[model samples]
Target: MFTEKGTLPDGIEYDGTLHSGYEIREQLVGDAISVFDDADVTARAVKNPQYLSVCVLANMLVSLGSIPKDKITGDLLMSMSQDNFNELRAAEERLDAKRKSFRAENKK
Candidate 1:
């Protein structure tokens, strides 16, 4: 696991530790394919764009300040202020880019 820390605009600190790359890929693919029993619902959910980002962030976020990982959810994240949510998204993007760069360099 790789962990990165940052503070949200609301002064809440977050841990964005990610699971293994393989696990993330599998989970995302599985969620995309099976989020709903009905194909129509799944298709609609997937088409939202924010749906995937929310799912990914929910999985990657280990904690918010004193909050435990198990208590974090997409609904909780969605309920945050727009600035906080955007900050979280930015943090996730930064961590993801860093991870990708590290992997690319290591493959050389």
Candidate 2:
């Protein structure tokens, strides 16, 4: 299931933290099953370059407060379908609202 669809650009390379894209996808599953930390969560996504889509991954992470828009790559994101992209965006918005409400209460 693990295959290299392309090569990393000469100037760009990723740290080897996962054995397979499946590993990265599986990590995303874990994120849903296990509660994420209150802090940023994007560094924890599945880093697959093929079957796994980064846009879907980044948005999911954003929903969890794992990554901000600045952390995601637009090139990779372009590969994701509109439906999945929308879901992630919706999740991000919902979570952002949740966070804001929590913060607002603390000031009261």
In lDDT terms, which candidate is top? 1
Report the Cα lDDT for candidate 2.
0.37
lDDT (Cα, tens digit) per residue for candidate 2, span 16-67: 2211111111124543433233222333433433323443444344322232
- What's each prediction's TM-score? 0.60, 0.35
- Residue-level lDDT of model 1, residues 9-74, one tens digit each, is 664334554322111221245444443555654565578777655655666666566666655555
Candidate 1 residue runs with Cα over 4 Å from true position: 11-49
Question: Positional deviation of 18 in candidate 2, in angstroms?
Answer: 15
* Reference-based lDDT, residue 61, model 2: 41
The CA-based lDDT of model 1 is what?
0.57
